[model samples]
Target: MIKYLGRDDNGIRKVVLNLFLTGDKFTTGEVYDFLDKGNFEVSYRGVSAMVGLMNTRLGILSINVTGDHNVYSLKESYKNIVGSVLENY
Candidate 1:
C-alpha cells in the first residue's frame, strides 16, 4: 500500500481513494470531473494514471470496461483496509 501511495502524497491520493469509499463505480473522466469540482489541481491524464495504478499496482479496485471507459470501484475485500488506511494516513 505504501509502495502504491508513495511516501509523500499531498493528500491527493487520499482524496481520490475517498471517492471509492463511497462504493460507486466511476470512470476516469468522472473522477477527473469530481476532482476538478473540488478544486484539485490535477489533469485528466493524471487522474487516469492514478486510477490505473490503483487498479493494476494496488490490486484494490475492480474495473469494468464499458465502451471506451473503464469504470472502477473499490473491491469489497479491500473496503475496510482502504477506509482504515485513509483514516490513519
Candidate 2:
C-alpha cells in the first residue's frame, strides 16, 4: 500500500530507499517531486500513502506532521535494518 500507489512494491521501495539514502527530512510533495525526477509518475496521493506505509508497516521511517505537512525521514535507529531491507529487495 505504499501510499496506495496500486501495490507496486518494487517501484515504491526503490523510491523510498533512494529517498532514505539522502538522509534528509522531506515532505510528501518533495518525495513526489523526487519520484518524478526518477520517472516514477506517481501522484501526491500515492506518495502520501507510501510514506504512511513506510512508517507504519515497514518501520523504516519517522514522520513528523507539522500542521498541513508531513515530513518524513529514515529512522536513524533502523538504518542498518533498512539498508538490509533495500539490499534484499
Candidate 3:
C-alpha cells in the first residue's frame, strides 16, 4: 500500500494512487487491516489525516463520517483524472 504511494513526491498523490489502484473506497478500519496485513508503513492516524487532506488537495470529494465511521471515496471527477493516468500509463 504505502510502497505504491511512496513513489509519488506528494503524500496526497501517494494516497490517491493507492485509492485508485485498489479500485474502491474503503473504511478506515478496512484500510487499517490492509496496511497491517501488507506491512505497509502508514499508521491509522496517518491514513485518517491523508484522507482529510485529499479533500483539499483534490479540491473535490471529501471523506464523510457516518455513525463514528469515516468512509473514503473518490470524487466523481476522479474518473477523468484516472482516464488521463491510464492513457498516459
Candidate 4:
C-alpha cells in the first residue's frame, strides 16, 4: 500500500482503474501477468486483494468467483463513463 497522509485508497483506486483500462474481463492471475509484462512492480497478493475490494466495497468491478479462475469486469455504470472518456481521448 502506497500511503499519503496515512491512506492508500487512492493507490488502490489507481490499480483498479488501470485494470479497467484493459477493456476485457480478467482473472487475478491475468492482472498480475499484465502488470508483470509491463514491468510494473506489483504483488499478486496486492492485486488480488484490491480486486476484491473494488468488487465488493467500491463497486467498480463485477466478479465471478465460481469458475476455475475468477473473472473481473468493470461494472456497467462505470463502463459507459469510461467508454465515453476513451472515445474522446
Identify the leading candidate in terms of TM-score: 1
- Evaluated against the true structure, the overall lDDT of model 4 is 0.68
**Backbone clash count, each prediction separately:** 0, 3, 0, 0
- lDDT per residue (tens digit) for residues 1-89 in model 4: 12211255334445456568656798989888876786677899988886787678667678887658899998777876655544543
What are the TM-scores, per candidate, against the unseen true structure? Answer: 0.90, 0.78, 0.62, 0.67
Question: Sorted on TM-score, highest at the top, how do the candidates line up?
Answer: 1, 2, 4, 3
Candidate 4 has a TM-score of 0.67
Q: Which stretch of 10 consecutive residues in model 1 shows the poorest summed lDDT?
A: 2-11
lDDT of each: 0.87, 0.74, 0.60, 0.68
- What ranges in model 2 sit over 4 Å off? 1-10
Clashes (candidate 2): 3
**What stretches of model 4 exceed 4 Å from their correct place?**
1-16, 81-89
Least well predicted 10-residue stretch by lDDT in candidate 2: 1-10
Of candidates 4 and 2, the better by lDDT? 2
Rate residue 77 of model 3 by lDDT: 68
Q: Please identify model 1 stretches exceeding 4 Å from their true place.
A: 6-8
For candidate 4, which ten residues in a row score worst on lDDT? Answer: 1-10
Q: Candidate 3: lDDT of 10?
A: 43
